[model samples]
Target: MIDSGSTATRRISRTSLVVALALCLALAGCGDSVAPPSLPIGSHRAATHVVAPGETIYHIATEYGVSVGRLMAANGISDPRDLRVGQVLTIPGGDRGASIGTASSGVRRYTGARSSRQFQWPVQNGVVSSGFGIRNGAMHDGVDIAAPAGTPVYAADSGVVIFSGTLHGYGNTVIIRHDDDYATVYGHNERNLVSEGTRVARGQEISEIGRSGRTTGANLHFEVRRDNVAENPLAYLPDPASSDRISFAAAGGS
Candidate 1:
């Protein structure tokens, strides 16, 4: 009986040891089963959550770790709550998309530089009465040359004639698309001497001055454009007072 009691005690001790080992293993696994704390997504990082049904802009912004103001400003959205259901809004620098504000600001500044490269005399002996900028609330995009009617207007540079005809406000207009992504428009013309697609040399006779385009007197409405956007002609062209020549009529002439 004594030997049997001792054997039973040893068996109990071994079972307790086994139970303790199993409990320790279970506890170690339970600690791992607890999920880790979520990390905060940055504004520039890629989005992790998609907008679900009934998700508010504030909720989306908070979920993505960005401010509502940032979302609106970056996307040019005036109203934060008015986002369309299917509109994919960028999370600031998310998606690696280009910033609209930065790109347009750079474009405006670069365009100012391009306007300074070349110039032309709208009329041979004309004086500039009005320069580009603002008239009332309307932005004046070109320079106004006060010359007598029938003053010969020469092509400002070598270009292919893109438009030559009468416009509603410009009267007889001639638009020339030149090389180096430059173009010039001669408006308020009494006569158009060039036709569409005609390749004209610099200083070639292209039109004659006239009082058109709701003008007060006979003058040449001259414009210089780059990539179709009108730039200030006065910024790029040389001063009309300095050059004694009437026109660039012989610039590209053989």
Candidate 2:
């Protein structure tokens, strides 16, 4: 019982409704094929999101393109593993999960002090198989510490995890950045315990020694980088001591 003009108007309203819903979904990062937005460079608004089942801090930080440490800091989250299914977290991006927003913004800034700790030997027990510098007519960027296949790898120093993933032949790698602007890289790990951007302590377990990338046996490929240049790790590691038990484990693993 409607004219053609009225029917067209009704159709337009329906289309508008659908479009609005789609935009909302896009903002929430749900049901859309679009890649999650990266954090914008300019001013932005704050948004709140309830943690969903099976969501991890790493996943949320990557989705928003913000550092996991920053995200955790924003919400005052002390423990990343303690996230609840319905827990509310403050997403530190633009409003509605949008990466960018206009000049008018409403977001609170989180100001907290970082942890102050030094570095320690990453692997609990291992024998030095390879040292830094040129080897076999090629550059050896790191030291290879031979360990058991599943020996836990500790943090050489306290720092924030800048990376936790694969890197070509490095295998399951983890790179931690220390307060002194030095970074340590742990490669050929069986498993990475900490996610990128999470603050870690000295002597904390970060991964497990493994031959994940291009190693012939179980070992940890350790590297120390300062301002992005490779350096010698032995210069920093503690001198071999009886407490290390490196000799005991080396005998069995070797």
Candidate 3:
């Protein structure tokens, strides 16, 4: 027979071991529930994140516990769709944080080199249903080109597709970063034919028009940005009255 005192001691040891294991499991669960840590101001230099496949700007911002607008502004990205796989993004930290405003309030400024690139009309057989500038007490950052559903939308100029995805208010959008400080936006697409990082030439079909996002009917919402500032696309586009086809003599054409 076992010694009675020794048996009691062994029972107590087993009970203690079970309690210890339970405490460890509880601690591990708590750790998993803790929120992601924010980068402390001045704790370290800004970190860089390499874009991985299937990663979007929104996901990265969430992972870093930063606002999407701040992350975009820090990188001079005016359109959310401009994020691409394999791109290196600078994570804003310390006093390097940037403030970005809504479309109605305007956005952070970016001073890129002067661009002479001309833009071609993105939608064929479309009419300007709405122009850019203040409308209904808010800023209309881009023009609405009304077209029938399924109308092909072309790239305004040659550029690499920086972003192509769905965005709030803009719906399915495609943003192209051209030479110099210029970029173009095409929004309200029913479908996007090109993916991010693809090189597109002027007049190449990138999307099909649709009544996506905040729209009353089928149309393509288009904008031209220089140095990340929205400009009146009409000023850059060939006058519709001049020609139905591409105009080589548009004011800003080379």
Candidate 4:
């Protein structure tokens, strides 16, 4: 009887062990086959993307709504036409499908999403008599247009008047602060029509052309500044070859 009881106990123990082992194996299989939750579409982390067959920088830039220059700047690329298959590239800046703009360190950000309006001529048919740059060992910060003293000066774009008074070396200046870190300056104005802190729309009258700041001739000195930093206004302005249009006014007469 004692032997039979011991055998029965051993058999039950073995059965329980087998059942536990089977249960553990089943749980392990379930865990292994479980699928992870998917991330939402267009939820991309900022990383390098591999170039596939038939891919070009222009096509990618167009598809992504990013500028080619910006893309190249972000990826440290010198040539846009020289892309290798399976090569890695970093996207510079993107909207990321969010209303808020991306904020990268050392990068300027513009929150307003308004379309750029057509700029008007500051002085009608005025020739750029002077160009921007060093003139006679002096830094000329804007272009000069030789217009009549009474010639009406129009606002380049719709913006608020930040300053409408005399400034050092830019006498009788009128500065308009526009969106996207843009600021237009009209210097050597004979008269300022709008006061500081007033808003003026594009093509609106803002000042009169004159030689006010120790200048030699009646002219309008205009400048377009980005983030208060000066750039070649000729690059951003309209092409002169297509039409008789002066897109921007450089530091000196052009």
lDDT of 1 by residue, 1-254 (tens): 11233656634533442332233223211000000002212224554344556876555543443433445555676555567676777775343222111111111111122233675655678655554432222234455666789999999878777678865566678877666556687878889999975888888999998876556678787767554434456556664344474332111100
lDDT, candidate 2, 1-254, per-residue tens: 11124646645533442332233223221110111123432224566778899998656654554434446657877566777899888876535443311112211121122122224677776776654432222234556778888899998877767678876566788887664446778888999999965888888889998888767688887766553444445545555676775531211110
Runs in model 4 lying further than 4 Å from the true structure: 1-119, 240-254
Question: Which pairs of residues have clashing backbones in candidate 2?
Answer: 119-156, 119-157, 120-156, 122-154
Tell how far residue 167 is off in model 4, in angstroms.
1.5
Please provide TM-scores, in order, for all candidate models, with all chains considered together.
Answer: 0.51, 0.51, 0.52, 0.49
Which ranges in model 1 have alpha carbons more than 4 Å from their true place? 1-116, 241-254
Residues 113-159, candidate 3, lDDT per residue (tens digit)? 22244578897786665544332222344567767889999999898
| Best model per lDDT | 3
CA shift at 226, candidate 4, in angstroms? 1.0
Clashes of each: 3, 4, 1, 15
lDDT agreement with native, every candidate: 0.53, 0.56, 0.57, 0.52
Better of 1 and 3 by lDDT: 3
